[model samples]
Target: MSKVVFITGASSGIGKSIGLYLHGKNYKVYGTSRNPSKVNVPFSMVALDVTQKESIKRAIGEVIGIEGKIDVLINNAGKGITGPIEDTPTEEMKFNFDTNFFGVIDVIKEVLPSMRLEKSGLIINTTSIAGYMGLPFRGVYSASKGALELVTEALSMEVKSFGVRVVNVAPGDFATNIAAGRYHTPVFENSAYKEKYAENLALMDSHVSSGEDPMMMAKAIYEIIKSKSPKIHYKVGGFMEKFSIILKRVLPDKIYEKLLMNHYKL
Candidate 1:
């Protein structure tokens, strides 16, 4: 029998690509989105809002009703928040974490019972490269992803005995709508760091617009799923991102910051 997969945030970008890629591979994929009507894929699409417990639970129930078992759960739906921490409001931070961090938690919680009962499953949480290396103007988004990294690590250990595996996929600047469509926070009328905010926005826009293709990430996900034993973390992107990870490990803190500031002209 073909493996069954559940993927969230399938309306567009990486989530959508994963759904299409897996479906082509003959997997029974149930794609979830806030608006299932907007998803163009032919796979079974379900409406889900990861931030809401009831929505996630209902979506999982719908999938289970048909598939009977979930072989893989891909937590790929997430948004981006860009701005200085000092300039960002407390409420905005809460909202960002609510979607990016707690939202994933809710999805995992709802699906755990099924996986536990079956005693076999794979959970792939879409973390960001920001989770590994902190970037300017993305403090809150980084915080959320960093939280996910920790959670995935703990989850890997906790679920190991159950024959369930948890892994984190951290992709660097990819050609996706995340930096554009996924970035939004209530702006204040007047702020001291308005100029800095503008600069950072322009910087982020440039990087993502000119980044690696999202399909590359889809291929990475496929490889991990095909692997017999996947690692706790998988980094996908261009050669520069791989080198950046190494540089961040070996270079001095000041040097790394200097390199980033210079590269982005910040």
Candidate 2:
């Protein structure tokens, strides 16, 4: 039987691109979206809101029922929220975790039973370089991804003996819907962080607008899954992320912060 892969947030962006890439590679693909009507991908479509456990449960159940086996589970459904930490609402921060962190956990928990029963599977959590370096106004988004990065590391160890693998894909900056409403800072009222916000938003917007094609990320993900043993974490995208990673390691903290501020025109 052909192997099957289940992907969340497959309606568009990198998730959708990954689904298409894998499908074209001959894997039976199951794609999920909150609005199934908006998903026009050639793969199977099911309604799923990653923020809701029930939605994830139902979607996975459907995939298992039809495919009888899930060789891979890609937790690609996520969003971004950018603003001063103080200006970010309590509910907004919670919503970010609800969708980006806990949502992936819910899907993993729902799918793992079958994976363990079969004694094999691969899990991919789509994260960002933000997981490593917390951006100025992306506290919530970074925190959510940071949480996932920790989960990915610890869970990889936890599941290694079970013949299941957990990995994280941290893309630097890519053209995707993840930045649709969140990357840009809103004009704040009485906000003392306005200059910082403006500078960060401008940097984020420029990087996102000119970032690597989503296809590069999708292809990288495909290659990882095809490997006999995937790494615990892989960084995608290009030079910007690579440079950030190196700078975070070599530069003094104060110097790095200064460089980032100047580079972003803050």
For residues 230-265, what per-residue lDDT tens digits would candidate 1 score against the true structure? 999989988888788889999999999999888756
TM-score each candidate. 0.95, 0.95
- What is the Cα-based TM-score of model 2? 0.95
lDDT of 2 at 134: 72
Q: Which structure among the candidates has the greatest TM-score?
A: 2
Clashing pairs for model 2 are: none
| Residue 218, candidate 1: alpha-carbon lDDT | 86
Candidate 2 lDDT over 84-187, as tens digits, reads: 88887888888889899999998999999899999999999999888887777887888999999999899999888889999999988888766675744465
Stretches > 4 Å off in candidate 2: 183-185
What range of 10 consecutive residues in model 1 has the weakest lDDT sum?
Answer: 180-189
Model 2, residue 157: distance off in Å is 1.0
Model 1 RMSD in Å is 1.6
